[model samples]
Target chain A: MNCIPIMINGLPGNVARIMATSALRDERFSFVPFSLTGEEITQGEVSVDQTTVTLLKPSEREDKINDILGSYPGFICIDYTHPTAVNDNAKFYVAHKIPFVMGTTGGDRQDLERTVKNGSVPAVIAPNMAKQIVGLQAMLEYGANTFPGLFKGFSLQVTESHQQGKADTSGTAKALVACFNQLGTDFEISNIEKIRDPEIQKENLGVPEEYISGHGWHTYTLKAPDGSALFELKHNINGRQIYVSGTFDAVIFLKSKIDTNDFEQKLFTMIDVLTAGK
Target chain B: MNCIPIMINGLPGNVARIMATSALRDERFSFVPFSLTGEEITQGEVSVDQTTVTLLKPSEREDKINDILGSYPGFICIDYTHPTAVNDNAKFYVAHKIPFVMGTTGGDRQDLERTVKNGSVPAVIAPNMAKQIVGLQAMLEYGANTFPGLFKGFSLQVTESHQQGKADTSGTAKALVACFNQLGTDFEISNIEKIRDPEIQKENLGVPEEYISGHGWHTYTLKAPDGSALFELKHNINGRQIYVSGTFDAVIFLKSKIDTNDFEQKLFTMIDVLTAGK
Candidate 1:
């Protein structure tokens, strides 16, 4: 099997660094020795093991990308950039006919989908990369489709706890809320209880002290009107390993689709990856 | 309407006291002016506003119950006693033909149900009396009956935080686990994470200072096999108000059932009360 050459964006970000480390360890993938860094990053390069990856800021990417692509033709791009940069980065990839995997969330999601659909390049875009979580989501979607209004009269309460630096409610929690809504709940995305205080994470949420800076715990509760019955669901993630594994799987899946010339399915999601085997 | 006389047992216990206070404030029922106390109680009575309820120890209850029953014919009994006293207390109520509410959990639940089913007198039995939670359980039962194995490939993690004085896993959490099992997750009762240490409860579980002595926070998490999807449900109760209100509702429901000569349905649960109107 030929090694898949890939460029990992969002270097210096923790998630991006983790993904890059994982890809380096995998025998199937080879890094292109280039990364797209935030404009604020003063460092020209980032070190990974013994190899140093050259970092390109937005101002320098336009001039540098042509040379990088010329050196590693048909190479795939992996994005782990900020939510604000999702759309602009996708437009850049599409403008260059460079197929990519968008591992970042936020930015106008609808526009992200439209960019991939209308453009020549196909991409794998998902808010979440964990296969187990995506499989659960597929099941939820199944429930929503097969049993809509199943929890119509049930009252839902969503609570999520992450590292203190996370400024917003978990996008995964918000997506699950949408599934709940389709299953007959009237919950608003904004109603999610975001627990970002380290004290609360330790004292109230029962998060381990070591994982205080890198974990995600979410819970959704449904109660009856009379307060007699309750149905609860929850997920606790201790680290970024799950995301790393799933990101690799997405890369492999997207590569297979590209190899098969399946450009018609230009826009794909984690759900597609989850159900691909089935 | 005739005021139904009720004798709330377990005097000095916080839960029973809260129920007594609620009952005293409601005009629909009248107190029997008596309570059954544990043998350890040194006090002869407990005060509630202007009314003083005479406390009867285990030694006194056998003799006192006869006289009290003769005084207030067909009076209802509300038991909020120790787990050890559950079966014996039920035996006492059953032998005397005095219908009762078994609010306390633990101690051979199947035997308790059998006792109610075989006895001539009727009773309301439930592990949890919180109306909203009971209603949610009803919905869970509906889903379980309607969609068994709904979460087959899902992995479940149950975590519950309670007061340090609580020696066992929450009965409510255990009950919800049964629901999840029926819905397709293979989780054992012993697998539930019971949070008891005050430091852990305060630091990791986020129980409030005021409620550390009397709170129950339960979280149930389900994740797909590949870690791609997750669904969570949670319930955080600060105090016993929910249980108190639901206890009162159960009493009212039981009284109505007796009034209509519904002796055939002697074994009623919180679900019966929640769905009674529908």
Candidate 2:
């Protein structure tokens, strides 16, 4: 069987680079020699493992993608770009009929989904790509559906700690808030406590010294209205390596769907990839 | 029915004072004018909700107990004393045939339980008295039993934050750790991250400005072996009021149990009170 030709965008970004490196090392996929990067990135290329991939800025991508696509006609794109680029990047992938797996969060999510749903290619779009976290999410979704309003009259407080460089509240935390809301707490996504100070992370959150620049920690606390009880849920990620396997699995899952000619549904989620494996 | 006569101990301690004041306002229980304070207490008496209760230091308790017992014959004692006092207090209660409730944590827990079990007086003993938190505990206990080792191979991290003055890790957090262990992590109680510095609590844990001096926040995070997934549980308590209702309910529940001659079992827990309510 032919290995799926793959182009991983978001060059030089930690997560994208991890995925690009994993794709390069894995025997099942072929890593394309080109990457789509933000205009702000100054590097001409990024080295992943033993291979170096040319980085294309926004100005160069429009003209450069044509030749790259012409050479690798069956190329699949993996996007780990900025939140601001999500929708436009999806449109670009769909316009060129390139199937993709998007690991970025934010951008007009609804617009991105609509663009994919009406487009010619199928794509896996998820705020998170870790298969195990995706499985846990599926479990929470099941709980929300099976036991709606289970925590009625409970007060919810959310706290998330990420690397100091992350400028926004974690998308995973926001998604979990939605689940909690369905479980009966009146929670708003904006109410999430985002902790990014290095000192605070080390002293209060107990984040390790080595992972100070690369971690995601989140906590959700639910209290009974009368202050009689409390329930809490938390997840802490130490580094970017944890996400690689899931991202690669997503590529494999997307390829399988494409091969099966499941073209009617143009969009998929981490949930689809997770369940398909089971 | 006549009000159940009650003596609130641990005068001057914040928790004991809160309970004493609560008992004073409650109509179902008559507050006795006596308290068992630590040896360091120099005050003769402490005021609670317009009532003054004599404070008996450890040196005075034995000599004063006889006189107080004569005045309030059917008095029930509520202990919010020191960890060092738990075992001794239980012995005192058992020796005098005083049916009591012990709300304090620490001490030789097993010895204290055994004292109550073998002694003639019935007692309610619990590490935590928040009804809703107890309820959540019951649910977690259920999960542990029903799904043993459910989180096998998942890495677990426990973090707890309390007021700086707290001298020990939370007994509640310890109990929850046992629950998590049974639910499938090789966690040791000593491994829990205990946050007690005021600055760290406020800045890192996002504790409220007003609650720095009085809060109990706990978080438990579990991650899949490959770091692909994460799960978390958390409970954050502010102020002492949340525990008052559960403590009072325990008093009421103990009195009812005594009234029914259900004295065969001399020891009970918050779990009993919760389920009895249901």
Candidate 3:
């Protein structure tokens, strides 16, 4: 089997380092030795396993991409860059006709989809890349579609706790709240409880001490009006490993889609990668 | 499509009434006219959607089964009887070589499964029968199987609120706790919070007034030890309709299994029914 040539951007970052390491070890893909780093990254190169990957700052990326593409043509791009760079990176990939998998969290999401839809290349973008969490969302989507207004008159409470570094409320929580809204519960996304304090997370929420630096824990609760019924759903992740596996799966899924020239649907979510076979 | 004849036990009970009403209207199954009822029930018959159904007391079920089998030889039995009757009911169904779908939530659950496993007939037994909720549980089971000890050192809190008439804690909650346990969370089922007071349900828990008489709501919250991560899962259901739909699906699934002589797996759960086609 031919190995797919893949370039993982956002090099030298924690998640990027892990992804690059995984790609270096896996036989299904050949890791490109070039990465598009942010302006803040001063390092010229970072080593993953035994391979040295050259870091291309924002200014150097445009001039360097053409040379890199000449050697590794039709390579897939995996982005774990800064949220601020989401739209710009998408435009860059689209302009170069490069198919990509984006696991970044922020940016103008509607425009991000439109960027790929109008462009020639397809891309898979998702906020959360854990397959099980994505599966849970799919199940909720099924509920929302099959039983709209099933929870009418019910109240919802959403609470999410992440590592201190995570600055925003979980995108997964917001997406799930949307599903509950369609199920007849009137819940505002702004009402979500974002727990960032280590003391509160440990004492009140029971987050483990060792994983306090890395985890994603979320809860969505629904209660009936009169006080007789309650429903709560939660998905807690301990580390970033779950995401790595999902990202790899997304990479593989996008490669298959590209291989088949299946461009009818250009923009994909992690849910699409998950339910691809089904 | 041949209409599979089905006997819905525990007539006059709220759940049985709904299941019978659903079966009466559905084209897939023929509802048996007789039901096996408890001895305390004074009523000789119950009318469901214009059809009068005879109630066979526990002692009379033995003699009546033979006569009923003569007319509906291969009928499927659906038990929505009291929890105390779970084991005894399973024995009766197995003794008569009758296939059954047990929806009741009590008795020696292990003994109930053992009775069916040792018997010649097949049965679909589940503590909870809502398809979406069961799907959620299936997702957790996947997590437990795929990532055992994924939440090690984390804490878990399980709370459930049902109709005031529900005398016991939710069986669904207990089953979910078991899954979390396998995922390395040290949670005891006995510690589950059983919120039966209507005041607390309505005032504090946010249960709606209208569904106070009939609803099932559950929540499970997990937190990391040091205060950084939290995961919560919930399934809230109002009214008995969801179970009715799941019951019908089980009946259809069980019927097909029996038709194909697929007795290799006799005891099935709601997860089996939910994932049947897949």
Candidate 4:
């Protein structure tokens, strides 16, 4: 089951490492590495991730991409590099007429999409790559839209537990909070509980990072006055593969839509495609 | 700290055994077997909970109580028996001026209280005996009371995982769910998810039973239409000692609240007793 040939554009970074390692395991996808020239590969000495390669710094990115140009004539460039370089990479992929999967989480997505469109090369991009989590997210989206009357009279508590190394509140968690706020309850993103300790968890009061790291375990509890009833929803994630699998599917689907040549679009956001499909 | 002597009326139940063992290890309390009847000495069969020396027949209760009456004078009775006999034993304690802790769940409460009042006895009773968990419950109670706003749209799913052989839906889980309803939501208790199989959990979700047992793990999640925001609350328990400690405190506290001279004139539940001097 050799995968569709693809060239990974970022191998030295955290999410790229996850993507590269996961790509190696995906039978449906095979790839080459194209290290950016000017980026710093801080994963020093030995990267515990299974991806077999050294990071090529940013100064070498152009030569590396150019160096591999002759070997693979029609390769999909999977750009998981820093967001600062998304626009440049988008232009590069279009100039080479390469379909690409962009998973780098934070970037000026609008600029990338606009550049990809003007250049007319196929691309797929999204924030999270986990499929089941996306399914859960998708389900949440539908639930919120359909059940406008669901959370009436209930006070809400949103809690997200993540690995200790995670520095910020989870973007996914923040997004979910926004969804609930729209359900008519007045809530700020600051209201969410971001717990990162295992010790406090032992107290049975803290949400631990081990419980949230490499996976997302999000729970919401709704309480109402008068103590008459209750509602609770929880999602437990076991690994990061849930995201990887979903992202792969989205990328493949996006490629199919682009390759059909029915529309002259170079790039696509999952939201835009999901919205257009609706 | 030297503690007061107490007679455990339900000599052999799970709760009784745990209490006895914990008491034996601590210097604050001393315990002895006073509830075992003559018939138990003759029959030599231990109760199912392995704490009771014998299951005294209903007709034999009075003689059994009288048999150890003198030596156990001034001692407190810890009742962890069936609720049907609450009135009977409570009356015996009141008549004997015994201060006892009733940890048994459910029985004819009206008659039991009436007898306790008529006899001027003191007792500590609660459906749940865990302090930390109770505190969580208390906080939820406060939240539900303080903020009675309904959420515009929300969904609830409760999954309680327990060790095998726990045949009952967790009373605490149900109580929390009820609290959630008051905080504002609609849900049916019967619809709550109950996962019991360790093999299934390991296979389907890769979670070990050791991660969840001897207590409860509950999760409630609320989401809005756009899947942008979520709210959650969860509780996980590891052992039974939590309940034991609170029950112990409740017992010691109840002992001081009931004035032997005025026991017949007062009726109180654990809330009234546990909240004493708070």
Candidate 5:
């Protein structure tokens, strides 16, 4: 099998660095030396493993793309840039006809999808990139689709806890709350309990001392009207490794789709990547 | 295909009635017309969907078993009896050379397995029998086996809620705690929070009022030592229907094993029934 060339954006971001390190180690992928960085990043380049990746700021990307594409044509872009950069980066990928994977959250999501759906390139976009958690979400989605109103008259409670630095509620939790809503529970995404306090996380939620700075924990509970029955669902993640693993799977899946010229849909989510075979 | 004959014990009880009703509707199995009831019950018969099943008490069961066997010789027994009767019931089934599926909780579980392992009958025994919950448990078991100490230095908290009538902590909760332990979380079964208060279930947990008397809700939370990461798992069931579905599946699985004379391993759980083909 020929190795797929991947241009990983967000050079110095922790998640990007980790993914780049994985790409370097993976035999199926060849890492491109150029990255799309923000204007604020003063560094000219970032080193991942032994490779020095040149950081292409917003102003430099357009000028550099032609030269980079000339050398590593057909390379895919992996985005892990800031939330504000999500749409602009996507528009860039589409205008350049570069197939990409978007791992960044935020931006006007509908507009982001519309940009790809109307463009020439295909992309895999997902707020979460944890395979197992994605699989669980798929299962819940299955339940929601198969048993619509299954929890009719039932009440729902959703609570999510992430690292203190996480500024927004969990996207995965928001997605799952939609599933519960379809299952006939009246719940709002805004109602989801967001816990970011380290002291409360440690004392009340029993978070371990070593990992208070990095985890994703979510719980969704549903109960019958009479308090005669209750159902609770939870998923907790400790670190970034699971996300890295899922992002790579998305890359492999996107490459396969590109290889087969199966681009009729153009835009895909993690669910599509997850349930591709089954 | 020949229909498997099944004798469902603990008739007139809520779970057994539901299972019997399902068995009657299902064409894969023919329901035996007799049930082994507790000695406290004075009723000689119970009507299930127009089928008047004879109730055999302990004193009469010893003699009635021979006659019932004369009629339905290869029938399988489905046990949803009281906790105190779990071990003795298994012994009786073994002595009679009858296959069984035990869904009741609170017996000396190790001894219950030993009895079947030492006997001629193959049984599918599980504490909880909701197929989806069982599938989740199987997934956790896989993780535990594949990544021992994956959660090393993590703290764990287990909470379970059931009907007020339920006298013990959830068997499913206990089983999952064992799995989390294998994953390197230090948690004890005794530390599990047992929630049976209807007010708490409704007011605090948001359990619907109608199902406060008939539900199984469990949550398992694991956190890193430094409180940087967390993972939470939960399963909530509203009624007895899922258990009935799983019980029937177990019966089908056990019958298939018996038909092929695949009795090298005589003990089974809902997990085995679930993953039998996959």
Candidate 6:
């Protein structure tokens, strides 16, 4: 198998580092130079090669791509960049006909899909990339699709907590809210909560981030008339490997779908690729 | 709707009383007399007509059965009888062609199923009967069936605490242990800790039970080869409503699947009844 050489665009993020580690372990892919900023280092960990670092300020991302054009040719850009560069970085990948693997969420999904479509870039984008986690989401999607408005009369309280640096409600939590909304839940992001500490794992709530770390816990509870009955479905994650494994699978999935002759015009998430058939 | 009059056998127990309440509340069914022994009297809280209570000793049961046979010819029996009565109850119900629901657990399951088959009585026998709880069980069943042997290399510590009277591990907890076994875990029930009080909750593990009365929590954590990746799934529940809902659904399901020229012979559990066609 010819190992597809890849370039990771997003630098110095936790997820990017994980993806890099996973890539090094995968036999099907060879490690090329990946980029990251200087500040977002995991304190005291054996740092990556400093020479490979691409220190571009968030504002300087436009010119950053120009510099990369000469350095990485014929390589798929893995965009683990912050949500701020969702468009600018995507545009760069599109203009170059460079297929990309986008694990970065928390951007304008509609605009991003439109960018991928118009740019004609073969890219993989997903809100969440863990197979088991995505599998749960897929089940929720089926419930939302097959049984529209299944949550009728049932009250919903969506709670998700991530690490301390995470400012607000998780994008995945919001994505689930969208899925639940399709199931007829009149829920708003304001109705959801993001906790940094372990003070409140209450009547019906998610455990706090400090208690849950590197862990992703989301719970959807449906209660019945008079508070007499309850139905709860909860998923708890404790590390990033599930996400890394899912992201690697996403790359492999995109590799299979790329048309060497023509720029692909379809916008597909990892779920589509991971579960392409059967 | 013609309310089907039913007889609740051995109705003095707490669980039997729960069934009685369900039977009284259910619009399709009407309670017709009850037989309870000893002095379980709860005054006005459980009043259904003292005259209707048929008090009987264990030795007088055969004579009482003759009297019941003379009066009621085709009434369904909801047998929440003791384990010792399992065989005899099945014989009586089957010989009279009386359809029944058996919520009593802990007897010889093989013998009970055999007796029900030989007697040709359409019966719904289950260890649990709460409807919505069965829905929760259905989710686990779905997870197991869809992703067989998925969570390998996962360290499972299932700490469940029921009421003080709930000696030994819970039946539901044992069932969850079986679920883990299905996923290739070789965990033994005797090895797991069983907490009874708030200190036991705080000592063995840091969990506090003051907040989790009659609570049952199961947590499974999957770690990576380097201990860097972890996935944890924890389901915590408090109270007996799940059991109530599960039992109710089981009754409704059994009633719908009688030998009345409708459905074929199908062995159903909470999983089948809760997901119902899914």
Expressed as tens digits, the lDDT of each residue in A1-278 for candidate 2 is 68999999998987788788778788898779999889898989878887989999888888888899888888899999998888888988888889999989889998998999999889988877765555555556655554456566789898999889889778778777888887778988888998989999999989889889988887777878866456777677788766777787778888888899876887898767765633
Report how far off residue A106 is in candidate 1 (Å): 26
Tell me the tens digit of each residue's lDDT in model 5 across A123-156.
Answer: 9999887755765666666656654555667799
lDDT winner, 4 or 5: 5
lDDT of 2 by residue, B176-266 (tens): 8898887679999889999988889888888888888888888878878875457777777888877887788788889998889887877
Across B1-278, the per-residue lDDT of candidate 6 in tens digits comes to: 46666777666666566667667777877666645333333432234433245545445555666667567655677777787777677676677777777777766789877877766557777776654334434445555555545455556666665556567776766776676665545678775667677676656544454534455655555444544444444454555555655555555666667625443453456555544434
* Alpha-carbon local distance difference test for all models: 0.81, 0.82, 0.84, 0.60, 0.83, 0.61
lDDT of 1 by residue, B141-172 (tens): 55555455656677999899888888977877
Candidate 3 vs. truth: CA RMSD? Answer: 10.2
Candidate 1 local distance difference test against the native: 0.81
Candidate 6 has an lDDT of 0.61
Give one digit per residue, the lDDT tens place, for model 4 in B1-278: 34656665554556666676666665766565555222333554454333444445445766766656675555677777665666677776777677777777776877776776665566666676654345446555554443332222446667776666778778877887776676556778897878777765457534444544454555666553334334565555545665566666766665565423434435545554434533
Best by DockQ: 3
Between prediction 4 and prediction 5, the one with superior DockQ is: 5
B148 in model 2: Cα distance from truth in Å? 3.5
Model 5 is docked with a DockQ of 0.14
Better of 1 and 4 by TM-score: 1
lDDT (Cα, tens digit) per residue for candidate 1, span A1-278: 78898889999888899888988988999888999887899999999877799999889999999999999998899999998889989999999988898889889999998999999878889888876566555556655654566556779998999888889778878878998897788999989999989999999877889889998888888775655445676777877878887777778878888899877979988766655543
Off by over 4 Å in 3: A224-229, B1-278
Error of 3 at A163 (Å): 1.5
Per-residue error (Å), model 3, residue A100: 1.1
Give the runs in model 1 whose Cα sits over 4 Å from its true position: A1-278, B70-73, B107-111, B141-149, B178-190
Separately for all candidates shown, the number of backbone clashes (residues 3 or more apart, or on different chains) is 46, 11, 34, 69, 38, 11
Q: Estimate each model's TM-score.
A: 0.53, 0.54, 0.58, 0.47, 0.57, 0.67
